[model samples]
Target: MAAEIRLSPCLNDNFGYLVHDASTGATAAIDAPDAAPIRDTLQREGWTLTDILLTHHHGDHVGGVAALKEAYGCRVVAPHDRTAALPLVDLRVAQGDVVKVGSLLARVLETPGHTLDHVVYVFDDDKVVFTGDTLFSLGCGRLFEGSYPMMWDSLLKLRALPDDMLMYCGHEYTAANVKFALTIEPTNPALLARAAEVTELRSAGQPTIPVRLGVEKSANVFLRADDPAVAAGVRLKGADPIAVFTELRERKNKF
Candidate 1:
């Protein structure tokens, strides 16, 4: 049976994911930003929480782990490096480690740009990746604990994945990101079209996440590090490639 993923909104616009294996009814939660919503969602779906996948140690990302574990007695799986601060961790995983939710297996990808402990979960068979704060719909996370180059390298690793892979980022920041892209590439047809689409979606109060990786490669300025036009734009602005990406991200942060 195929894996089923459900998106649950928690703590403002942050998303918490519930991934389940349809065959055995085993389930895992990806980043518990808040416990109340997670508790309510589990009850509504009639699914038991078997494990907690912690991507990082941020309060918004790990705040609910204690409460959820106390309520459900589920194992907490987090990065080995961050377990010292994450007291609820039951399984400490690192890059290349595999964790299971029923029949589905997710490979751990260390992506430490948003935070030094950040890790992404990729379910190859399901063609989906849960990129906590490392990657966003059209933006990347702020380099809180890592440098520009570190963040850029992390993003490059993700860009190497198959284009068809679905990117399930942590936040819903597509509209704002597209607006920033317009400042850098005002004449880009793809960016223009995507901006319009994001406007409509936001107006309708719909989420613009789980955007296809292929779509991001084409239109996402952060992911277009090697594009000649983008490089030229950076040169014209008297900035290097990394500086260009950082400047773009900073603009987005303010947008």
Candidate 2:
């Protein structure tokens, strides 16, 4: 059976997701930003929360885990957290690990940069990925606990995924991200069209997410750091892709 996915906007700009399987009545929340919205979503969908899959140990992502777990007695899965900042974890996963919510299997890919223990869930059968804070719509997470090179490598791993995959990120920052992207690839037709679309979507108060990886590969500047045009935009022509990427990130920090 096909998986049912729901997106819940929570806590200012954070996004919470629930992936449900009908065959087994198993539902997993990708990240619990807050308990109220997720609880409401669960109640509305008539789906019981059986699992809480965390991508990292960030407070915003795990804040609701405890409450939800207490309410549903669900298992909590998370990446290895040496800091002990997160709540109780029933399972600690790493790269290449497969986690199951009912019969739905999600492969874990370690993607540090947003945080040292960050990971993303790729549901191959569903052609969907939950890219926590590691990747945004047209941008990437800021280098907080990881270096530029580390983050770049992580991004490469994601970029290598199939183009048709549908990507869901942790925040609704597409409008701002696209605005920054325009600074880098102002003349790129794909980005221009995407920007217009984002503008219209935001004007209607709609969420700009669940974008296809193929579309992001064409317009996301962070994913295009290897392109010569991107290098030129940052006045780093003929420079290595990593150098271009670093320059772009630094500029974005200020932007």
Candidate 3:
């Protein structure tokens, strides 16, 4: 059976996810931003927390790891990067390694851009990907420890995934991301439609995540750095894709 997922809001815009395998009654929290919210959700759902998957060492992402671990004694699986100061990891994983949460398996993909130790979990059998702070709905995370090229390559790795996959990111920044996207590709119908959808979702106090990766492949300006139209929109028509990507990132930083 596919893993059932629960989305919980944590610390303003951060998101905490619970991945449950029904067959074995095993549940894993994607990243614990806050223990109170995650604990409350677990109690409400009546699910025992067996695992805590750490994407990176960011405070907003792993702030509640210690508390959750202490409460539930759940195994903490973190990236193998020793430089990242993560908390109480029971298992350290890296690229190509598969972490099992009961019967469900999550393939680890190291996407070091937002942070050097960042990794996203891809559950191929369930067609779901937990993109912590790597690939957002319409925007990518800012380059804090990695270079532009490094981030771009990391994004491409995600872009290569099957279009049918559903993406669950770490934060709810789609509204602002769509606004900045419009400045680059105002005439794009996909972007326009997505903007409208986002506006309505936000107004209704809904989360704009678990979005189709196919939709992002077309509508996300950051993912279209190689497209001629996007290059032209940024006034670097014939520039290299890296150059275009760099320009776009710089502009979005200011936006």
Candidate 4:
């Protein structure tokens, strides 16, 4: 049986996901944006919530954790927050830790950027990555707790993943992200095409997540800090990839 993933909307712009292992009937919620919506979805899908996997300490991501845990007794696995910022974190994992949802295994990556302790979950065999807010579709997360260099390193690590893997982020910011991406690479045909498609999906109330990593490499400026074309577009020719990334992130702050 294949892994069944359910992308759910929570809060105003946040997204939550529910992944169920078909072989073991074990289910996991990736960032509990809110409890009611996740509960509703679980009930609708007839899947039991056995685990709550968190990516950061943001309220929009963990807001529903307590409710869901109380209702389902699910184990909460979050970043290494010794202060116990989370309502309940059964385990605190860092880079290279392996978490399990039934027989399915997910490797934890310490992708600190948006937050100092932020992380991403990778189910290698499943070819899926729950990126949280570290890497979005066409843009990366805002630098709130970490520096440009920190975020850049985190993103580059994710860039090493298999090109064919599916990427699931933590927000419904695809259209806006792609819009901002155009400023850096307006002539990029792939970027332009993706922006148009995103416009159509958002207009029709459709999601543009679970995007292919390969597609993102071509379209997401943050992911392509090392690409010569992107560097040239930003007038930073011959500069280090990290320099280009810093400039791009600064521009996004104002965008």
Number of the top-ranking candidate, with lDDT as the measure = 3
lDDT winner between 2 and 3, please give it. 3
- Model 1: weakest 10-residue lDDT segment is 231-240
Better of 1 and 2 by lDDT: 2
Regions more than 4 Å wrong, model 1: 235-240, 253-255
Q: Work out the TM-score per prediction.
A: 0.94, 0.98, 0.99, 0.97
Arranged by TM-score, best first = 3, 2, 4, 1
Q: What do the candidate models score in CA lDDT, each in turn?
A: 0.85, 0.93, 0.94, 0.91
lDDT of 2 by residue, 92-210 (tens): 89899999999999999999988998999999999999999998989999888988889999999999999999999999999999989998899999899889999999999999998
Provide C-alpha RMSD values for all models, in order: 1.9, 0.9, 0.7, 1.2
Tens digit per residue, CA lDDT, model 1, 77-137: 9988853377578898998999988889999999988888889999999999999999887
- lDDT, candidate 4, 52-156, per-residue tens: 999999899999998899999999999995753777888999999999999999999999889998999999989999999999999899988988889999998
- Residues 1-255 of candidate 3 have per-residue lDDT tens digits of 389999999999999999999889899999999999999999999999999999999999999999999999999999999989999999999999999999999999999989999999999999999999988989999999999999999999999999999999999999999989999999999898889999999999999988989999999999999999999999999999999999999999999
